[model samples]
Target: MDSSDFTCVDVRRDGFVLHVVLDNPRSDMNAIDRAMHDDLTKLFRMLKQESQARVVLLSGRGRAFSVGGDFEWFRTLRSPHALAELNRDAKQLIWDMLDVEIPIVTAVHGYAMGLGTSIALYSDVIFMAESAKIADPHVKAGIVAGDGGVVAWPMAVGPARAKEFLMTGDALTAAAAERLGLVNHVVPDAELEERALAFARRLAEGAPMAVRFTKMAVNKLVKQALGVAFDASTGYELLTFMSEDHVEAVDAFLEKRQPRFTGR
Candidate 1:
């Protein structure tokens, strides 16, 4: 409830809408690091207890909604203990987001990649900027699209289209994403925040119990999908964390070069 309780994420209240900003100071691009990841998990869990909050408007503070996972943090997952913690946190974050009864409206801009894309996809409504791009580029990092990506993308765009983008780690423009039904709306980059916030405020002003129950009912389908696939996908992703190819991919990403994967 209190913004002071979090370090990486910024939380504030505007009337009945809770404004949650992904503002990781460690990355100008707002990449999800360990701190941000943990903060998000805690934030969503706390949302359930906030009596005054009726809706959540989630966005980013920098040039990006998020550029996916921090490669520096990825390096730390090489250890078994770290990977186990990641697996737990990844699943908990997605589950908590789904469990929260409040409707979440996301305003995505710049780049929303990997976990970032997953977060946006899970929201009840998504508003993407015209110049912004979205992608689940876990494959490019030599990892599985396990953290909500596997569950959300296929549901949004269908399995065939999802597989194409997920496997190739291809980026989709706002228009393309809209065409695929991946996002609810696309606005000019400048108007992204205003439009998304307006919609969130509208949701907030609606009949509270009716809105909350509607969201809860709709999320049953998502929760079913999460139950069916999330654990297995994340488990596979953790296995990939120990792969030689994952090591090369992270190395190349940081070194600014193409990874030479040997399928190890």
Candidate 2:
């Protein structure tokens, strides 16, 4: 796969492990704009054909893994055509990630919010920095936790706990996330990359077929869950794009004020 095709994500192969970085040059926080979203979907599809890649180490550059959707980008989605494209890409990204047979190990530092949290949670294993945090704050933006949040969170921390965080759009510290069974491990901020790389290398060095098949077998259950919840949740999310409240939320966010939602 030619990494040059991606402007939002940086892809580099290190031996048997493919290192994928969520580095959006347009945004210092690594926000997911249209380009990043499409790049991610394409990247995963390419991974399926990467014969040399046995494992993937996914991370972010700069201050965050990702801070979720670019608020500026969110404004453009109010149009029906733009929203329709977003819906298609959103579903495709989740499905492609799940379909890829290679094991993905995510190293999350700083903030991973909204779609960012969903991406990390979908990984086969997660290594989070002790000072970092995760949150699916779609509700905060007056949107549904569609994407992968509805599917991944409930499976990770159970329905009750998932509902609490999802509905409130609250952030969870790495320690708290670890206790809730959301993350696989929590290392110090300084050790996060090294520890995660070691783990990915371990997977890469393992018997290739065994590792791939094991991941495939386990992901069947996730695919089943996605079939049940993903489309409906994404549909509802798209509906919110047309809501008055969603516009207010986006406007208020950009203006840096509390949104006054009237439940339109």
* Model 2 bad stretches (over 4 Å): none
Candidate 2 CA-lDDT value? 0.92
Tell me each candidate's TM-score. Answer: 0.98, 0.98
The clash tally of candidate 2 reads 0
lDDT tens readout by residue for model 1, 110-224: 9999988988999999999999999999999998989989889999989999999999999999999999999999999999999999999999999999999999999999999
- lDDT of each residue in 1-264, candidate 2, tens digit only: 757979888889889999999899888789998888889878878877778889999999989999999989998888889988888888888888888899999999999999999999988999999999999999989999889899899999999999999999999999999999999999999999999999999999999999999999999999999999999998999998788888999999999999999999
Per-residue error at 151 for model 1, in Å? 1.2
